[model samples]
Target: MLDQDTPHAAMPGLEIPESVAAALSGWVQQVAEQTAGPVRAALEQLESEAAELRDTGAELEAARDQALAASSEHQAEIERLTVELRDARKLATEALVSKAKDQLAIDGKDRQLADLRTQLERNVAAQGSESDARLAAEMELVGATTARDNFEAEVRTLRGQLDKSYAERSALRAELETLRGKK
Candidate 1:
């Protein structure tokens, strides 16, 4: 009898003649060949799936990069717009301040003209049609009146300019507000 611990006795309870052993060995080889076909098919399918996953990962990475670039571009545009808006606001404020100063100057001129007219009236009342001095005083009054009229005309022109500047400033503010609302 063969030693039970030998490699040939590893299949327990299998007593085979030499011819039977040869036939069984051929059957095992056929089974192994059949199993190998399915195993190779399964390995090929797994490799195809892995390749698809890699391609998909690459596509996803490309999409992520595109999204990041677009976001950066958008942020840059926003920064540019913000700078332009600040500049516009600064210009509008300067214009308003300039207009206010012009209006104040016109008011001062108007006050000066009023004081001159009052002084002339007092002089006329004090020297009631006396002589050549009175005539000279009347002439002076006429010249002062002309000067006052010129000053008033200048004031009117300044007021018109102020009004135009204010209108322009208002329009700019409205546009700024609209831009801010879009954000």
Candidate 2:
């Protein structure tokens, strides 16, 4: 047993021989020296991996934010196009109604001119008035046909635009879904 004066005898009843303690200390020192380099290298590799993970996280966050912004813009554009398409459809309906009215007027005028032509077959003065009526009806019909064609073309263009808007919105939704899936 070691006496109180021994350096390793601080704990009572646990005294060790000087030579045995010295050998144990030496062994511990040797083991520490042997493992220090590998332990430090492992710690350094772990720190590097953690740093890389943090950088990747930041980049992923930025990309997600950008995708969200783009999705917002696409939704707004789709809504605006929807409103414009609705308005164009209303205008096209009015144009169709106007065209139908013009057609009815033209049919009535055609019938009246036919009657006049038949009666004027024997009167030269009446024949002149009949030609004038026919020319006026032709001009009116031409104007109405041109207006109807223009409105039909506009409707077709609006439909095409609406289809494009739907497609763009669908693409955006798919992108958003992909982003969410990644998360």
Cα-based TM-score, every candidate: 0.49, 0.73
Which lDDT values do the candidates have, in the order given? 0.61, 0.81
Task: Look at candidate 1 and give me any clashing residue pairs.
Answer: none
Model 2 CA deviation exceeding 4 Å by range: 1-17, 32-40, 180-183
Best by TM-score: 2
RMSD of each: 14.6, 7.3
After superposition, candidate 1 runs with Cα above 4 Å error: 1-14, 106-183
Candidate 1 overall Cα lDDT vs. reference? 0.61
Estimate, for each residue in 113-176, the C-alpha lDDT of model 1 and write its tens digit: 5665666577876334334444554565565556555555655555555555455545545654
- Evaluate model 2: give its TM-score: 0.73
Cα misplacement distance, residue 124 of candidate 2 (Å): 3.3
